[model samples]
Target: MFIGAVPKEVVGQVLATVPFDAWGNVYVGCSGSFRFDRAVKMRHPECRVYSNDVSLLTCSIGALAMGREFPVKFKGALAFVEPAIDGLDFRGRVAAVMVAAAMGNFTGKNEYAQVHFRHYREHFRTFVDQALPKLDALVAEIKIEEFYAGDFLEQADRAENSGGGMACFAPTYKGGYERIYKLVNENVEWPAPKYGIWNPDSLPALIVSLEERHIPYCVISDQLLADRTPTTEWRGSNKPVYTYSSNQAASLRRRLPNEVPFKYTPVEPAAITAESKVSMCVVDSKRMTYLKNVYLTKGIEHTTGQINCLVLIDGALAGGFIFAQTRFGDKTRELYMLSDFAIARERRLSKLIPMIATCREVIQPINRRLLIKVEYIVTTAFTTKPVSMKYRGIFELDKRTADHLQYQSAVRNQSIQDVFHEWLRKYAGQGGKPDRQGQAARAEAAGEECALHDAAGV
Candidate 1:
């Protein structure tokens, strides 16, 4: 019910459109500030109101402000009080359950530092002390069955099964402040009962689960409504809202099959060859367009130099590596940095080593007229330790800094060449021949190498 920053008129419009009946019950989860709860109660004076929150201090303040009896002990209870009236009649009994921005603030230790926790606790105390006394009339007008102190998802699960009504949830959207916090933090385990909006996948998973459970639901967001495609007509600011109903639940159960499809397709290993050809050539803008679509991370805007090399396996585009002039320091005088690189997900790691090694051949000739006589290729690995170690093995580890693991380009291309030679030896031992197709690819690779050497007068 915390209507932070939203105009009162917008709140009124949203409350007016909620699918509810007179004298029904309404439940508000994560009822911070309880402003929206008060507004809802005022709109439907006869309806019994129930609220649940994790903080006892906030709940106590809410009780005092509204002139309601505060619970003596709060032990993560799912529901504050039972519905004043309950029966098999699911439609008109329970009105609309509104969950407004009810995501947990406790992301983890890395992001939720000590200072943040201190500030939050101090702010809560100050706000409650100043605001609780002024809300007496707002609290007294509506009957609150109980204020449960616990996780929102647990309460929501209970509410969903306790007969059907319109359930509305406005969770913190993905890619918001919370997501940024999670991304910045390291060694953090998000505590659960994690609901939709906890992670990017959680919301979709929640919807799929609801569909499987026969809980009909639709996602609503201000962006979605502003685009003029709402699941249900509503009057309010285009704030994103997700609603599920018993009727939709029934339909979803009927439409979806019992089993869910497997989430991923198995990738077949790439064939190894004694004459497996990897040729690197400067890519045109058109090819760059195609690479951007397939590269795992980074787009053209992040890249800085013209020396973008396309890696072709035999004759198809298999991978790419882009180099940029160093913009960080005087290092530009001696380095051509590897800005972005990725192999197709379907490609094998055996192929990756050789493909990466090809950068050595590609870089040498390009440096002939380049601003800097490229002495070293540098890059940072920002992934987990194991993955960073893998990168370090391929590109010799230079140093471990606070922000990233830095790697120096190998002195010789021998690491990649050794891997390729080993694979070729195995292939030859297995009686594989250098066939016409393989020979043609090898010839093409040799020709490209000759062209680079010729251009560099090497």
Candidate 2:
């Protein structure tokens, strides 16, 4: 059901500007429609084109489009693909790798009906069984050397290291929803929902990783914003194609070599003494949203009864936690769920205990006014820690939410209180000395006396 084809204009731009040399291999990752693969084959018949994908259905489609025989068995497709690529001779050839990554999960119309994991697994297995042999034979006959079936990042790394070639990534765009809807309106039957969209933020991380590894690459995306525009002239005429090449290809690489992956030094536990004042206060929604976007993976979803708390160290935003009303089956006696709880990566380990203590303290007063019982706190393992056997009373796994194991902790119980008090002692120790108000008062009095003396002298 995923949209397989990239726009022809985009493909043309890629074909026109991509720095592929004669006798070079074009390695395509997530080659959905094989549009780029076929184009490369026609343009440079002498050069080999290699494609990689994780999905068997997609691989089969790619094979069919390339006029290659489908693989008979799916089980050994992975076994054959990896070895074949590893065996290829990349010496003295211009290898251009294209990756059309499948990075999103789709919600099919039959998703609710397809309840069991085994059912989905078996359904996919059947297609793999049918497609593997044909795909294997297709790879053998065509100029394309291999069809890798695994993680795109891993394969990309391999292609960069072994082939030392130019890499192209055709990630999904923001306007993809509209395109998919249009396709559906035209009765162009695609899967119910396409999951993968190229997030602009993800590009910098990828660029940083490639740069760190010294891999020469280019991103062929319409969705990439103008900020990432290379200094060189864009070659494509039809589509507004933005290309970022390595320093070897263009000057953009030289301008900003270390643009992303923020630098930070890890804070030591001993650095935060007992007297260190850890201030917790309510933060604005805007600040909470900013932190969530930067730190949390999925970002924040505004919900009812949501409270955002910021943990400040020396008046600087060190960390934060978010609490929202729980949605666990009908028992709504003012229960809450904790989520988007995080500290700056640099201060994670050292600040964890303090962050938890701060969260507990901040939530206590908020609960008092609403007469909120806070019977139990339910949080997913994706966002919080796992429910270990040692803390049975404090937390337990709720299996009803099957997709992600939800961990629930009873907040009203003595066990959780004891745990929090113990952590508070272990992390935040005794209080620091009170403010110097007495000294300030005396100074003010002396100043008044000086003013009177000055008046009498006058």
Candidate 3:
């Protein structure tokens, strides 16, 4: 129920601070509305772009408004679930960091009235839970709070002086409810439409959860507290105070808003499957590395032959993207190499946690075998070696952390040297790669059979 808004001046500052160009694509994340079409005209009015909204009404309005306002074409639609960002290619990639999230309207009758009444202000807190205790037990539960109920909130929702229907948030329902508002606390973690009104905080939740890993963001805030609110509430005049300030009108540099500082890059859990041109040079190099290093000798007949392909998910795309390997079951078992993952350099581990959860979900069904368990092979950073993990696994790289064989710790070998030998010895124990050995042995065998060419006349 946070009712404050960043002023228009502040909004100008925030938008101006955003860095977008023709080179990189920008990603916009919002729950419902946006505030910068006119500003975009005032700012970089030349860029052609696509915009989308989850609310059908807002998307239509924005499309119409953008078409009329900017000579440049603006295209896109809104969606309840964040639309997948891949499948689009353009000259520039950018970040449309939105400030309005968790603001989708609600449906309960009495619940809808809280947006207006003082008694229910606390009820509008962003993160509402079904079982979670409410800050104010007296306020109704979400089922009661979400919709605009007429019975419980008769005082605030009574008919206007005209004696007709009141404005928005005032449900005519005797009990059932419907409408939307900006809320706090709940966000993309629980992305269904019921929590509360859309607000500034929800944007960060979306960025971190979905786009944070791959995209750079510039926030577009919808602040209600600025000097230009409709009047006091939603029913006021639709026009804002600064209809269209002069292009040179001083842009307001904003004070820091309440948002978590992003710090870590996100991880893409699975790989994407799409048709695109891949060069033979790159594909061969990848196959060479995996074949020589991973599947050479040993019991590779087990998995490499068993699971012929590999899939990669670059979570840094828009939230993230999936990359899949294919087309070459031609040889033994075919496999696709990989692409370095993309992620935001400033998000936290908490943001990436979901990626792992999602990756597991994507591969879980296929990764597991029916009779004898097919192990889940995960690629992790070298730093993660210290933590104890319980699962049958193999390291993508050799680090001292993974060890079950005790003989490697024996004397005549210093601890560090012994550990190295332990891993190297076990790894090399399988001998030369099949590809390498096959080439050399075949060469030698050919030479021996052709002694006449090697030595003398005949």
Candidate 4:
């Protein structure tokens, strides 16, 4: 331990006892992430999507990593989503946010913060004298509340409150009880937000507290990520100290409007680029409904994307690929059918690969920041209760194997243009076979449908 580093477990127990949290979820503020970086994606496989858009890294390089000459159509954005309600089993769905520099304290207090309070104080009066405390105090209060409402309340309420009973938090010895009491009582407000090199003692306490409350949180500490460099500019009087792409949903706007009327204007987070996508699926007509999910999973399996979407081409695919109607902000997205075909295993061979290769052609490649080779990565698939899970990881596709199918300019001179045109044809033609439930719900929102028709002998 350094001259003044305290045991993290002691502090974690103290904070846990205070019961900080809103519904037992640790809400963390953070700096944005460069791209996919985590165990979740590495361990699961369904997240793979073939993006015909700007790569997350090396944004300027274009889709170079997806080097090819197939008919590539560009998708402005990609998105992956899961049901928010009971998305995973109780123990699996616990969402933990760790705010690091820029979002969480970049000081010793926040275990993941890389800089200390002293380093932060070097900048100005705002951090050390004011902002830091407000931030920390808010965290403390929230942590306590999470315990009361989500942890303890759930314990006394139901068995399904995300492991909210005695088992998650049975017993543990806290050694520095007297010491933590002393630290908590210290009225010594930092001269500035302590900004020396960050210390990691804070996370242990948060983890400890979470155990006590039966709340599950994943650690996303700044000290534990790729982008960690101490700079005063990222910090400010009001902005969070850090930000990450995953936490963007919450961090971008620290506060939201309340149900009650307020005197001041209540602003909302800036709208994100909602994804507009489509997929083509081939299935045995007799089993369409039963095998639809499996077919959809297959498209995701074969594509290289951050998000995947599919359009089923039964006998209905007379034109091309069709895009269902949806509007994102002022931008209207179009869907097209790049190819047309019948339902067969051979179709997967001739159609699926060519279709995927086409999408790969148009997208720019990733080159900057922490670069990772995509060729070796594979998505892991597993199912645990509420939702079938998918994540990303490293795997290999051997080009030297006799099974490897070589392509002609990435699939017989097929270009991104071919892909997009096909997609547009399908999207503009007609919507998918009637979605009874979805139709009933969208009855209120004004919506339009598009379709495409194109056919060739198999």
Candidate 5:
């Protein structure tokens, strides 16, 4: 589902621009497939190449491929394949097992399933026959100095402090690692990562974080169009790959490619009717990141204990709300804090959708079913003005701070569906539907360039 494997073309592009001769050590953070690590080791044999990833399974495979001694013994299908895979030492044997497990997990069958089902033995035998030889060859070629399993930020900090080291980060894009590596993670008993994954939408923040902390780094992403930053673009296997560097001099040395700026096209707004609806559902990290980048000023925040929800207006993605458990000491009852709220610029949806979304009556029971008892809902809006227009009608301003305005709202008694229907009825009675002829006349008066206004929300 998630492949960190960098193509040879991109690797060549990276090796050409990065000033590896200046640094004694190179750190590869978020080493998903370790393809870049292998390439770096192959090119710079004299340099100490280290690989670090958040997943234990990824580290295990990386360690074995790079010839590091793995301490853990695997018990299951791999153990049963001792007869098939021969002449492999402890590291090779473990590597073979882990690689096989990862492959099986990628396909619907996990280690447990492969171990239990007799039909799955052929898959293991197939890997032993076809894939193990490649792994053995890679082990012979790659010699990674060390492999680390932890947060990439911590690893990057160490690289910066080391004085003569550089970090290359290919942070996971759009889709987060949680769902992509779910099967392999569960099989390895790896705990959920505490760090945030970066996508094109959240990459600018990541670059700023690295720069502000004075960390020397380069990033490889597929969709990032770096703004005013030193970047080199290359044609990837499927999409264009852009490498962003902290070293402006080195980046400027590379020739720039013919590139096009990214644009977002908003979906046409549907007319409000009795059938027009509002709903909320769980939103994935990928979708949430895109929405945040388009609508919210701060983009995505790397906070723990947060649930992302999608706000739908007539089945279209109108907005999003990120709710987190209160970080403060509140032993009284479970409190839900609204971490971030955003709405589409094109769709003029009511703020009531988000209001009901955060209400205790609406979300409380849903969380209660999962064993969380929520009583109060709280939110903060950061703005220089005395009041935030977004929260004026929906949330009651409870307190105002020097930097932000805090708001609290009471839960409504009616269900969200019932309230939505009533609101629609009232809207229809008020002739809320727009006049198409007037809209067309305004568009003609504004001209073709004005039609591009809807392209802001992507």
Candidate 6:
């Protein structure tokens, strides 16, 4: 297995989004395992793929993968390497370095075999039986036209000047690659890296430079750079992978066939339309239990011990929302926080359904149940998207923290029954479902059941 490799599903989605088919030349910077290079070559055989990196081990492996010679001289400094590695040929030497590098201890100052004897032994034992075959297969299919050992920016400049080319950069987010390859460097005496680990702080300037130059490019980053929002985000991985593209690339991508290339596929609920009747009813927290740990990447646990409500669209359980006393500001201020919100997988409903329900319908019931007047309501959303489309028009953007977007709005002064009647009048003569509407109004009038709890198909 390759270290720090992008997930295969993410690679597929990136390929699906990027307009690589139209470009003749593609350059991959910081090509640690050459994963992107291999993917681009596999998809478009006509494109010439170039791989560049500062690590000698990476370049050595690339050379061996292409049946070329290993340029570095070991000078017998690698006596710690196992004898089974067969140091006589390019392929065997490649195997030797790959195994040793995997076994080396990068966290510490020294990486001698004695320091990590057990790891070195284990990797040596499994190199031929497990790792070699994978490498052999990779070499057979990979047809990268050239491999360069130099600064990544030099290669990026080449791609930028090529007139019809694209560049992909997957830089090391954290420092210490130099330490990881210290053992190999000590033996081969490769030159010092002209560039160190990529500083995420430098991303904004680099993005601006690439855009000003009109270079077609993509950058893979660990954290969402909120200064300039990414053109698109792929959620195939556990943590969102943010991809920033140049203006030229963004324009070209928009012209491609697939307009929506996100991972979430739409499966619209049956017989639901813009005219469908919508209602917000109080429900047992257990009714919204299924969505408890799924609203965000961290899970739905954040909304636990908070108030819960469900939204019905066209008399069908569309989704649910949760809120509680504001976790940030003073409790005496009478502010509530909309902690979590989600839609059912089967229903491709508008997000406005939940927003409007939370604001207009649930406010009075929640205020009455809690015995307080909620003068202001706040909500937070986490996304790498340029705009949180759900709250763009309805709520005022209060502030943006590092992790999420915060929005607040004043609670409307209307009664629960008044809001319900207003909704019914708004959707009048739209072939709306009036059956559940009357039931919801009756439940609210009784004060015991403020919401329609038809848990039939939730």
Q: Give the top-scoring candidate (lDDT).
A: 6
Count the clashes in each prediction: 8, 17, 76, 103, 0, 2
Q: Rate the local accuracy (lDDT) of all candidates.
A: 0.39, 0.42, 0.24, 0.22, 0.54, 0.55
Task: Write the residue-wise lDDT of candidate 4 on 61-100 in tens digits.
Answer: 1122222111111111100101221232211111101111
- Per-candidate RMSD vs. true structure? 18.0, 16.9, 25.0, 23.9, 18.9, 16.6
Select the stronger candidate by lDDT from 2 and 4: 2
lDDT comparing candidate 6 with the true structure: 0.55
| Candidate 5: segments with Cα more than 4 A from true spot | 65-89, 96-120, 174-176, 189-200, 250-458
The count of backbone overlaps in candidate 5 is 0
lDDT of 2: 0.42
lDDT of 2 by residue, 379-402 (tens): 543211133221233346674321
TM-score of 3: 0.25
Which parts of model 2 are misplaced by more than 4 Å? 1-3, 6-53, 57-277, 293-305, 328-334, 347-360, 381-396, 400-403, 412-458
TM-score for each of the candidates: 0.37, 0.38, 0.25, 0.19, 0.47, 0.49
Sorted on TM-score, best first, the list reads: 6, 5, 2, 1, 3, 4
Report the error of model 6 at residue 93, Å.
Answer: 0.5
Name the lDDT value of residue 2 in candidate 6.
Answer: 45
Q: Write the per-residue lDDT of candidate 1 for residues 1-458, one digit (tens) a residue.
A: 23333346645555544444421666565565566556766776675666655433334445444444432311122121122222312111111011101112433466556455445334533433333334434456435566655444444444435432213343455435334333212221212122223333343333322322222233323333221123333445455433333232122222112112111111122444546654555654434433332232111122235565554445444445566666774554445445444332222332353335434565576666474556567665532132352353456676764324667663344433455454344322343222332232233221111111121232
Instruction: List model 5 lDDT by residue over 237-262, tens digit each.
Output: 56777777655543352222321112
Q: lDDT order of candidates, best first?
A: 6, 5, 2, 1, 3, 4
- Write the residue-wise lDDT of candidate 3 on 240-322 in tens digits: 32211111112331212211122111122222112211110112222322221111211111112222221112312112122
What TM-score does candidate 6 get on C-alpha atoms? 0.49
Return the number of clashes found in candidate 3. 76
Most TM-score-accurate candidate:
6
